[model samples]
Target: MAVIKAEAYGHGMLRVAESLAPRVDALAVSCLDEAAALREAGHHQPILALQGFKDERDLRAASQLDVAVTVHEDSQLRLLAATRLHRPVRVWLKLDTGMGRLGFAPSRAAELVAALTSDPNVTAVPGLMTHLACADAPERPENAAQLARFEAATRHLPGERSLANSAAILALPDAHADWVRPGIMLYGGSPLADQSAAGLGLRPVMTLSTRLIAIHALAPGEAVGYGATWRSERPTRVGVAAIGYADGYPRHAPNGTPVLVRGQRVPLIGRVSMDMITLDLTDLETVQVGDVVTLWGEGLPVDEVAAAARTISYDLLCRVHDRVQVVTG
Candidate 1:
């Protein structure tokens, strides 16, 4: 089962999910509303609510829709216990396993499982699951440590288990249980610093692009952008792109970070403002307005872009603004 949570990591949940529907056994989402939207869109795939029910009404609705709830908290368990649904609710028990986020403690996991299983309203306990904390850094011993802890917590449980997220699915063979939840890899982002999804045969799913709105010829002393952060050392041609921080483009991209224009690499020249970024296009002639400028994807890797921006590809990919039309190819 693959979880299309958070708008499929900000890469159009519906499009991503629909593309993967044939291969995925089921879909997992963050809440009931997302599940309902998918259902309305003619997606009949089993939807697992990762956060579980928000209230009694949500529990009833989930029961009616056959959405499985991830029992992550005691309050949710209680809510499930109190709901008078016509059918039993299926659930996945979450084990904390050192993430310190959701899920019950290792020692307490069995008890919670027993509690949920014993309830008449609960129909089935399909699996035990945990999120990897450091699977991206394969050399880090913490991955093994977390796996050991998870194993210990789930050893006596009879149901199937899910411990491999995208990183674990690619790197940790032992961590691959009955099911795998891959996120970043599906969008062509590298989960490991040393490896890219392309090396593992995955394609990038989103390509952020815009047009070059203007070109400027500048003298040596001429500056570009709001802060005048970059000045030409010699005669230069600057290309202004119709994208900026407002469109979730990273504002922290320092001067000289690469931006692709007409298959040529142009270094950014100045501060990225709310609506624009200036790039040094001096050597590249034949530039004009309406030329395609890719922010990241294809020739430019999002990971490299994020590195230049001093952030992660996940943030950059997910933060794209509403003004930018998202087209899935």
Candidate 2:
């Protein structure tokens, strides 16, 4: 399943879903609203609500929409028991398995399984699933420990199983089980610190770009942007891009983070502001106003910018602003 939550990681859910619907077996969203949007857009693939559900209304809507729900807590289970749906619903019972987030304790797996098995509102056997906490760092012992617990907990249970996210899908084949949920991987973002998306054979789905609107020639000591964070070291040339923090370009990205200009690499030279960012164009030849600048994607990897900003690729991908126009290829 392709994880299309957070507006398909801010690549635009409906657009990405439309592009991917014919290719994937199913799609996963963080909530019912996203799934509903896909259904309303005429997507026919099965949809899974990864965050489970909200209330009785959401539950009923999910059932009528034929969307699967991930039931992780006793409260959600109770809600399922109390609400009468027009038709049987599909479910994935989440196990804690050491994530320390959602999911019931592994010890209670059998009880939940029995409840789900006995509920007339449920259809077929509930699929077994759990999330990996740190599959990206393959050296970490946590991944192995979680897998062992998940295997032991579900040993006697009979149902399809799933335990891999993007990281696990690449690093751990044993946890593939019956279903594999690929999120960041689908967008071509590297989940591991030591790996690159190109090395993993993934293609970027989104490329954020804009054009330079201004150019400045400054002598040494001339400063750039807010707080005068960067000072020209020579007879420096600077290019200002129309893109900024307001467009989901992270403000936390420090001076010297890379930006691609005219297909050549240059360094971002100042603090990112609400409506603009400054790039040190001293090395690029004759960069001009209206020249295209790429923030991330294609020649410039989102992971590289994310690393310079002290964040993960997921954060950058998930926070793209709604004002920006996005279109499918």
Best by the TM-score measure? 2
Candidate 1 per-residue C-alpha lDDT over 1-329 given as tens digits, one digit per residue, 9 for 90 to 100: 78688888878788878888999998989899888888888888888888888788889888888888888788987787777898988888888887889988888877877887789888766478888888888778888888899889878877878888778888998999998888788788988877866787767777888999998799999888888888889999988999999998988889988899987888988999999999888888688888999888888888888888888889998888778886654
**What is the clash count of model 1?**
0
Candidate 2's residue-wise lDDT over 1-329, tens digit each? Answer: 99989988988888889888989899999998888999999988899999888789889989989999999988888899898899988999999898899998888888888889999889988999999898998778999999999998999998899899999999988889999999999998997769999999988888999999999889999999899989987999989999888999999999989889988999999899998999988888677899999999999999999999999899998878988877556
TM-score of candidate 2 against the unseen true structure: 0.98
Model 2, position 317: C-alpha lDDT score:
88
Worst window of 10 by summed lDDT in candidate 2: 320-329
Instruction: Identify the candidate with maximal lDDT.
Output: 2
TM, every model: 0.95, 0.98
How much lDDT does candidate 2 score? 0.90
Residue 126 displacement in candidate 1 (angstroms): 4.2
lDDT of 2 at 251: 94
The predictions' CA RMSDs to the true structure, in order, are 1.5, 1.1
What overall lDDT, based on C-alpha atoms, would model 1 receive against the true structure? 0.85
